[model samples]
Target: MKFLVDAQLPVRLARFLESAGYDTIHTKDLPHKNATSDTEINSISIRDNRIVITKDSDFLNSFLTIKEPYKLLLITTGNINNLELEAIFAANLQFLSELFVSHSYIEMTRDSIIVHY
Candidate 1:
């Protein structure tokens, strides 16, 4: 599935996703960059059919409360460097790649991915 990597995540994640063959974009590419509002991000995700990969709990709140984005991959890996974070995603490629097809929300830690509906 396609993905939109939020500002809190390093832009490297977006590059990694693209190299892995999934359509992906980082918030840095948007006009507002880090200042982009959640509402606008949601709108973009909806318009583009992109799942949001974010470290922000606000996205989780929006999803739980009102289902804002098309889907979510909430990174709960906690303050990790880009290389390690990229490693976790790469190692979990099979799961991460297929996750959005059947799940709307997923919490991903360094060790495991938990699907939440």
Candidate 2:
């Protein structure tokens, strides 16, 4: 899977994903440290068939302008501590990987995960 990690995430997550054999890009790698807008990031991901991994709801509105994105992984825990977020994913990586392998939008909420295909 290919992913575009949003600015809210640590860029280190990208390297981790890469080490797992996924194509991953982090916003920090863009031109200037704060150069990207969520819309532009969404557009690039869609145009290139990459899934958007974001904590921002702003991207949920990108559908207003663009017609596609391979998928979206919305982490809805809200300002979760970095270690907590990492631990959650680490505990569920296998399920998450399976979900991503099959769906378009996956919302991971505090109590449940909803996958939209």
Candidate 3:
């Protein structure tokens, strides 16, 4: 799976995904850096077939209203530190990998993952 980590999320998460053998790119790596606009990100995601991993509700709103970006993983574990967030991702990525095979939208909290097909 390919992932485009959003500005709000840590780059370490992208590194972790990359280390796991997935193609991953954090916003910090983008030419525009973390300032890259959502539309541009969406365009890139669609063109590259990358799943957007974000904390922004605007992406979900865009997905709901326009169905762009192709796929999304919305991290809903609010207010967690970067270490905790990365830990959660590392721990649950295996479970999520299965869901990604059939689902396009996933919301992961501190305790559980909800998949939307």
Candidate 4:
């Protein structure tokens, strides 16, 4: 699976995914860097077939209203440190990859992963 990590997420998350053998890119890699707009990110996600990994509810709104970004992994694990966040992904990355194969919108919370049909 491929990923487009958003501005609110740390670049290390992207690096973690890359190290896990998934193709990944963080917003900082873009020309506009973290300033890259949600619309543009959505466009890139669709064009490149990347699943957006974000904490932004705007992408959730767009996904529900217009199905943009191709797929989404919404992080709802509020206020955790970056290392904790990475640990979550580390423990769940393989399952997450499998979930996305059959799901378009998935939510990751502190202790659970929810798959939305």
Better of 1 and 2 by TM-score: 1
- Model 3 clash pairs? none
Worst 10 residues of 2 by lDDT: 61-70
TM-score (C-alpha) between model 1 and the true structure: 0.96
Find the candidate with the highest TM-score and give its number.
4
lDDT values for all models: 0.91, 0.76, 0.91, 0.96
Q: Which residue pairs of candidate 1 clash? A: none
Clashes of 2: 0
RMSD of each: 0.8, 2.1, 0.9, 0.5
The candidate with the higher lDDT, 2 or 3, is 3
State TM-scores per candidate.
0.96, 0.82, 0.95, 0.98
After superposition, the stretches of candidate 4 with alpha carbons farther than 4 Å from their true spots are: none
lDDT of 1 by residue, 5-71 (tens): 9999999999999999999999999999989999999999999999999999999999899998989
Q: What count of clashes does model 1 give? A: 0
**TM-score for candidate 2:** 0.82
Error of 4 at 117 (Å): 1.1
Q: Could you arrange the candidates by TM-score from highest to lowest?
A: 4, 1, 3, 2
For candidate 2, what is the lDDT? Answer: 0.76
